[model samples]
Target: ATASLASQGTANIWSCASCHGDKGEGTQTVPRLAGLAPAYLAKQLHDFSKGTRISDSMAYVAKSLSETQITELANYYGAMSSPSGAQPALKGDLARGEKLALSGDYSKNVPACFTCHGTSGIGVGAQFPGLAAQQPAYIAHQLAMWAGGARHNSPLGLMAGIGKALSDEDRRAVADYLASL
Candidate 1:
């Protein structure tokens, strides 16, 4: 599992660690896989394979692996411990972002991000992902993807709707705030 996580073993393939970090800690624009729900990780792998989620790199990587391999990788990352004190990369209105996270704009009819992402945005079971400490670029990019219809793996179009509803500044603010958490 460590070998697979750290290296792809062939020049044609890309290692998970190359993007997600050796300890699954993640870097800018890459999400931390450590301590994520096994089921969530597996589901994302499956979704990547099936095109429900769209990422050119991930699709290629996921398609190269068998289902068993995906499950193994997911479980490996899931069992690992997550590091703390991640820093924010973007500059935005933290107060406004907090309000958006805790209380959605009623005029826009958008629901609070915490409604599904958990009170602290650390995730909710295997359904939602932990937003706290994630990379701002990744979060912002994902929101853009959802808004643009390039990614559609969220349950019932939840992210898509929210992403579409939020202005670019709001998205950045939320991303920055979430990263600060």
Candidate 2:
């Protein structure tokens, strides 16, 4: 097993919670893991292991994990309920994001987001990760990374293409809307 799962059914050794904290509350630099959309989590693990997605250490760590381990972690994290409710304030362009999420611009040739991301961008399936209320900064970073070809782990294996199609504005808009939800 990977170091990530060293504890297994025990309370010793390093568990994901060692750094991430129980309940997925992250420390500085480490990231929260609970309530992450299952699809998103799976993609990230796949990408890291495949060297498509990366972090200074996670790239190697992810690749080292067995498929079973990856699946277990993904399911564990996804099954945990997310922190509920939207953030305190609104932002500059939610209406535009709402438009794109619900109905795309025929002129722009963009498809409606819900078909793939689900009605609320909450996602569905063994791969799709819920996006209802993820942090905007994190979402924006992923979008930027995906656009730059740094992150290609996707539930349907289509994020690279999707990222390619989305402009910076569109990414921002959709990400904003997801955060709103």
Candidate 3:
């Protein structure tokens, strides 16, 4: 049932694979869902449905799903172990990115990505989804959204604050570095 839902979808909704890609590898600006924590996926779907996280396409698709469907889809995608197909598209300072990931700049008050996201950005749990190998454009876009108050579902506004602290160059640098992981 979950497979059908992911690959075929209902008449009212589009298949998850259409945009997220088969095996959940995801393309540019679309998140790779494979191996993400199931609870994180579910929370994101709920956030999209509730408008707390803004993405028109995701909102529409998430709104169409029932709780059961959401669970199934989340589980289906969460169980996948597909390798990332992402390639860096940004021309940012990889050295700075690496520094930011491993040792955050205290003067800027920006925390290391791995502090919450886990070592190597592999993700810690439901609250901190893996950032390694995510699309650079998508990462940068999300940072912009958080900084601009367009996306505010993060815990205690942590992401919003961090996003605000990162400069455009910083965002690109971090994004490119994470994608390289």
Per-residue lDDT tens digits for candidate 3, residues 1-181, read 8898898887899999999988898888899999999999999999998888999999999999999999988888999995878877899799999998999888999888889999999998899999999989999889999999889999898899889999999999999999998
The lowest-lDDT stretch of 10 consecutive residues in candidate 3 is 82-91
TM-score of 1: 0.93
Worst 10 residues of 2 by lDDT: 83-92
Mark the 10 consecutive residues where model 1 has the least summed lDDT: 1-10
TM-score of each: 0.93, 0.72, 0.98
Badly placed stretches (over 4 Å) of model 2 are: 1-15, 18-21, 25-32, 36-40, 64-68, 85-92, 155-157
Best by TM-score: 3
Q: Show where candidate 1 strays beyond 4 Å.
A: 2-12
Give model 2's clash tally.
6
Q: Can you write out model 1's per-residue Cα lDDT over 1-181, one digit (the tens) per residue?
A: 5465455534556888888887788877888888889999999988988998899889998888777878888888888888754676777788988999999887887899999999989899999988888878888889999999988989888899999999889888998899898
lDDT tens readout by residue for model 2, 65-146: 6778788877778777666443413242678777877897666667777777777877776556555666555665676777
Give the residue spans of candidate 3 off by over 4 A.
none
Task: Give the CA lDDT, 0 to 100, for residue 33 in model 1.
Answer: 85
